[model samples]
Target: MMFAEGHGLHPGHENLGGHIRFFNLDSGIFVRVRLPLLTDHCVLDSVEGLLVLQRDEDTAIHLLHPFTGDIVELPPLTSLAMQLKTDYTEATKLKLMRHISASISVADDGVVRVMVILIRMMRAAVATSQDTEWSMLSWRVPSHYQPLSTGGKQYLVHDTFFEDIDPDVAQVFQMEAHLQDTPKLIVTIPREILAYPVYLVECDSEVLVVGHNDMSFTHLAVHRLSDLVSERYVPVKGIGDKVIFVGGRALCVSSKILPPTTGNAVIYQHPRELTFSQYCLGSSTWSLATDECSMSMSGLTQGPCSLIPHVFTCCSRRHWNKGLMYWRDNEPLTWKVKQKFRDGVNHSHDPSLISPTRLFS
Candidate 1:
């Protein structure tokens, strides 16, 4: 499922009611989910199949399940400000909430853990189901590091270097344990490559660092890191038979899970335009998946969109648009485009001229 906030028509089309859209990957279907509470909210992150939406009304954060329409309300941002003993105005509180980065992890036993990085205070906090309270810890995270959570662990990645935060401290928010080993370095990028705007993605059990070079063209280098404690980051020619989707969140899917045509490719949206393209790793080329007519007509470029890999579980099946489509096994996933609500109108771009993949050297 690909989730996009705002309008489905053009980029920055926030005025089209500011609804949440869900594109079903299995059947190429689009479902628009409306959030009344999120009228003035901003999405901080998506994790464990839930979206973290921060309400502007009172600076409260909400956990919204797009499909089920279930919302879990967390404590407000003012609570954290008070706990930190910091006096802040409402405007400052709102600004701080917007800049903070967060991640969520859920265990098999249904234990949910949330970690947040307070960029303003340069501190971190952890909240868990057991405690039901925010544990603020004093760990000065570098301004460069971005918080990422995978498999119940939180990490901070900057360029080629990544540091794994101790899960113990993250679970209980123990400042002492975190202070003992502040920013434990796990991996570093090789000196030969100039990696800027690097993104860390966890696929299965492996961690992949994708570095995009924008100096000449938009070239990308993929490096696989060893264990969490290992210092080596080895370059990889390919990612077997899987397709990766990169954006605010990076996701990888096995070829068996998606259409064979999408195999061995990297699918991503244009950072500056309302368009999406595929980078074929095998052929080292870029191709447009959606035609210009469809893109322009649908106004698909207006908001924050995601390429989600969805799986169908039940043996029962349904088909739309064409012949029989099976849901079981590694059936090809569909792509969806959506929009959010904002105040301004967005201009459309010609996707033909915006070759995100071709920019790579």
Candidate 2:
């Protein structure tokens, strides 16, 4: 699937962390693209085949479709930006803010909205396409995202990225789009959890959390946001024939959606480390994937929304299928993927040509 991958929203400003990474995850192979069109804006988050982007010129948020080139603009953050106290740290400065992640949704009425988390605020703010400016969120406890929008609600995962955080304190919230009602709570008291950080995901219309047992990430937890009146999390015994792919968005799909052998397991890609591993629920053990695209490297995170059914990606895949053998002066970006076996699966086509084959050999 196509997801935004980058260190921060500000492209090139945060120590060369500017720019977005779009990659695809088929049964197991990895194909990535570098967007030349999005070279300037900082991409904050993505969902449902739409990207939440921040304009470097004014920091206004936008929903962009990389393929159709459609754009939906939202109001500026003037109100939220003015909330920054002069004494705030430089990193948190409205202009220099780094580590800002955005999750978005579109109402049935065609209204667009977003929830943004800036490290400087230590809290999140919500706004919609109709709003004059941003509105600060007063969540009872700090809830964060890897947020997914489904069933007309936006879900925020707890902010477990805090250091020295109490392991017992974590929550998953069903956020109301209009900010009129108190958030619905799903408490998952992970007292037995380690410091490996937690993530929220939606699968089969149910919300779940992916946490680690310890620092190793070798042991993981996937619990359903309970449907019982208690509103607590329940352990998922087995995923049946579904495979959970955890990354920017925790996606659960049938093994048939990917390679035939990729089922009844949880595949995780470390958000920062970009490492991939699989844990089979049936086996209750971790093992290396032996699929065709078994192991590869991009040194970045993947998955948020949508899927592209192909092998090679150019700057935009702008003309990858056009059978073109010449460079379009504008499409200058190409990706290099390294396989674990040192097979060095580089796109060996003419550097300027749009290719469909996997073999550069």
**Which candidate wins on TM-score?**
2
Candidate 1 lDDT (Cα, 0 to 1)? 0.48
**Candidate 2 residue-wise lDDT, 17-134, digit = tens:** 3334444433443443344545445444555677666664555777788766788887665567676556854323554333445556677898887666653355567788887788
Locate the minimum summed-lDDT window of 10 residues in model 1.
313-322
Q: What residue runs in model 2 are displaced by over 4 Å at the alpha carbon? A: 3-40, 89-92, 95-98, 101-110, 138-146, 149-152, 157-169, 180-184, 190-197, 212-221, 228-234, 247-249, 253-261, 269-275, 290-361
Candidate No. with top lDDT: 2
**What shift in Å separates residue 356 of candidate 2 from its native position after superposition?**
41
Q: TM-score for model 2?
A: 0.59
Evaluate all candidate structures by whole-model CA lDDT and list the values in order.
0.48, 0.51
